[model samples]
Target: MDDVAKGQNLDDFLINLADGLSRAQSRLNRYPVMNAVGQQSMVYHIPRLEFELKLQMTAAETPASSGSGGRLPLQKKSRVQFLPVKASQHQSSSSATSIIKGVFVATPLDATVSQVRLSLSVEKKAARKAQVNVAVIAAPGRSVQGATVELNIDRELSERLNKTPLKPSTRLEQASLILNQESVASAGLIIANQEPEGQIIALIADLFGQTQTLLYRFEQG
Candidate 1:
């Protein structure tokens, strides 16, 4: 199908799905039996990603044989992984681009959860066409080997239609996050580290390559 036809079909589907869900929720709320049966709950959306990070720690100590009993102070160090998803849009061969901050973690307890935003200005330089696939490594806070990670791409949440094998022209466009699930957890060796931020960086490195030269700015709110 052509681009216009595809766009129309996608819009219709989304509208119908939203309407159906709304009706179902209303019916469930109005029925006392259904409400008591726990069917009155509404489906909520959370922005999340599946990520993992490998960390190395080190410490310094005094000799055990020292009878002087001098200061036995200790020290520590760590490494981290980071993957940030920002809202983006692309005009059909336009010069300027617009970006809306995408919400990452939205929970009832911490409704004021902080978010990380990124803005990249792509210059008119020659870059080879490449495809990047982001994945999550499940780490459930401990060694439970053989854990798996997944990525979920939501076209509506982040704006812009889904397109695979995107072609880059002179126009700079915004990219959407391909998330793993509503919430992300780590398992196995990764969980042993207990480092959420570090894992995010590692996952991004695996998908987008080295970060030595990548320009990144972190905003907290």
Candidate 2:
């Protein structure tokens, strides 16, 4: 009887163990099974370079000519250089800015002058190239007492100014200025160049009757 009882207990234990394993398997089956397909990952990127063109303008003092009995010619000095800027995803195009500083000499005939204006033109070679003029001052300010002025250039704005035709006389008279006593003045400008590598020539004029040109060369990145 002891042997028989032992046998019966062993059978019961085996049956319980089998039932527990079946239950566990069933629970696992209820949960979703995931399989790894051919593993794949993808990424896309675009590279670009950022650059800036800086221009500075100042008054050029010519030496007194011996023939003119110590009289000097009024000339201006200008310079341009390129500056590398950090790349940004938001900036898609290259741009330029000019900072101009100078002095205005007043004469006896400049009493009627009450305002001053500044204009900019972008050229390629010797021909006038139409570019976007972001800020072209048709009439800058009523005070011609010699102060700072700013101009801007871009593709969109230049197209508009090109469409509006002006006579040669009007264009020539654009930056004429009357003499004033104040010697301190300043100006600024911004421009955009679409080409990746080339030369850009900029001509700037002020109502103070002075004009200056700047040249720049660029290379591919």
Candidate 3:
């Protein structure tokens, strides 16, 4: 920044920097945020407005559209800084030793990027309501009591923490229960079933300050 503001007075530079920081803060304040899941992988929602604008810009920059004036660049960018997930925090009930922090990336469907494969076979409780079951093991050789589970059919599973005693209307989206080897926690909720690939299912198990999260792509039958 100092290089870019060459020859500028120190006082003027400080004022400009402060103004820029303030604008950034204001932008963050305008966007709705879900930070309860900060313990695990942080999930951020790039405003739909930005997502849509990005699409328009992509179209404008394409080879066929070069003759037309390109879309103006956006001043701000949204990013997700993926932190290294510590193994001790996430325990997976499925393939116990197979994944770290309960989240695993499946092999690539094509040749380039790896992704988690979407799955189906959910037992439907009613129209638009799909039932999901998850087994949680907070600790080994210990009573899995006092553990709670939260889940929902969201575009991003790790979006937020669902509170217990959720409006009866949304009871199935989140639930609490004693977890154990023989016990399973389940959540059922009415859904849009939007994408062609399937909806994402996120389940979180929290006990004694330990958290386990699973991000699964769920396909509708």
Clashes per candidate, residues 3 or more apart or on different chains: 16, 5, 0
The lDDT per prediction is 0.26, 0.31, 0.38
**Model 3, TM vs. native:** 0.30
Model 2 agreement with the true structure over 1-221: per-residue lDDT tens digits? 23222233333534554565545543332222222531112212112222222232222233333655446554432322222234441322333434323322223335565433333333232222233121223233444443433322222322332433222221221232333344333232222334323433223333333222222232233
Clashes of 2: 5
Model 3 clash pairs are none
lDDT of 1 by residue, 1-221 (tens): 23222233333544554565545543332222213432222323323422222222112222234334655543322222111223452223312232223223323433233222111121212222112332333234323123222222121221221222112231112233333452223211111122222111111111121111111111111
Q: What is the C-alpha RMSD of each candidate to the true structure, in Å?
A: 30.0, 39.2, 23.4
Q: How far is candidate 3 from the true structure (C-alpha RMSD, Å)?
A: 23.4
Please list the residue runs of candidate 1 whose C-alpha ends up more than 4 Å from where it truly belongs after superposition.
34-221
Ranking by lDDT: 3, 2, 1
Superposed Cα deviation of residue 71, candidate 2 (Å) = 75
Candidate 2 or 3, higher lDDT? 3
lDDT of 3 by residue, 1-221 (tens): 42222333333434554565545543342232334652233323222221100000010111223333657543432222212235454533321221112112222235332221111234666555667666544224444444444333332332333322122233345555544445465556555534233434444443332234444443545
Off by over 4 Å in 2: 1-146, 150-193, 219-221
